[model samples]
Target: MNKGLTAKGRATRQRIVVATALLTREKGAAETTLDDVRAATATSKSQLFHYFPEGRSDILTAVAEYEAGQVLDVQQPFLGDLSTWESWQKWRQAVLDHYIELGQRCPLGSLTTELGKSSAEARAILTTLFTEWEEALFLGVRTLTSAEPEAARIRARSILAAIQGGVVMLQATGVTDYLTAALMTSTDPLRPTAEGTD
Candidate 1:
């Protein structure tokens, strides 16, 4: 009985968090209101306060964590296990398609920016997301080579950096070409050896 109630409580809290993340993504962090969340989640003000006593900033942090998870969720199994060329291609397209569809409307980027780059909490969350994301990419690169673990890791970092930089440019220019170019350049260093090329 206690466990059931705890589960229900957790579900309710998650509902609030997800509702806040979606609304903030669509409306921007600064523009989002507790009333808006209350309305969207069909949660009462008292319930909202009970779940998040600190108000907006507390909820914003939870939303940040949620959005951070989603930023790479689209890549899925392919992102986690890139042992084949086909899987790598799938991961690449998933990333490209995601940003392309997102266009200039980037909820995750907006949330992080609003949170401020200098905030230690925000920076730590972003850093953890990037490291986890890079590990996935590194796994794919390692699958392509056996003798260069360190080199593959470094190359993977470069690819990740390029993609991030490209996303920033995409936000500004509404173009995916930069992202495409960056992915290409990052993968270039991983081409099969001359003997295997043929």
Candidate 2:
């Protein structure tokens, strides 16, 4: 969408996206409207169209991309390394803490449902996010466990699934137990054995 624009124009576009993201997080993507975005960003309809020619879908696609980055950002440092059990634990805690605090306000669920049918472009963005997330976890698993590559990959996918599932439950029930337990179970294998085996 940012094919050609001055730095100031890019900044203005980004400002709109960020504001829309905040509104989505607070009110949900399904509930959020172009009017809400306009009010939040103080942008007129023409300005919004100039920045996002496709209107709400385009802005939402951008926000989905941005929120996808945030999903990985919260698990950073530990997510980057995870070469040791300690680092994995730290990463686990970071994931747990983020979702627990977010509770029902988390936007992933709403984004998926809202964009799944609206546009292939939006769906692809989310697909990329999950792929990137799984690859990061797979790298960590490979580094920390001497298991076969395929096994490590499966483990990483399972862990990622656990997180997504737990978050779904957390959003529905407003309870952290589901997420907490899910992380513990999914990460248990990554912990070193008492015999110091990894």
- The number of the candidate with the highest TM-score is 2
Write candidate 2's Cα lDDT for 123-157 as tens digits: 88889988988998898888777778999889999
Looking at model 1, the pairs that clash are none
Range of the 10 consecutive residues with the lowest summed lDDT in candidate 2? 109-118
Tens-digit lDDT track of model 1 for 69-184: 88878779779887666667777888888888887666545545654352456567777888898888887877765538898788889988898778878766878899889987
**How much is the lDDT of residue 135 in candidate 2?**
90
The clash count for each model shown is 0, 0
Model 2, residue 107: distance off in Å is: 3.4
lDDT score of model 2? Answer: 0.83
Model 2 residue runs over 4 Å out of place are 194-198
Runs off by more than 4 Å, candidate 1: 1-5, 115-119, 193-198
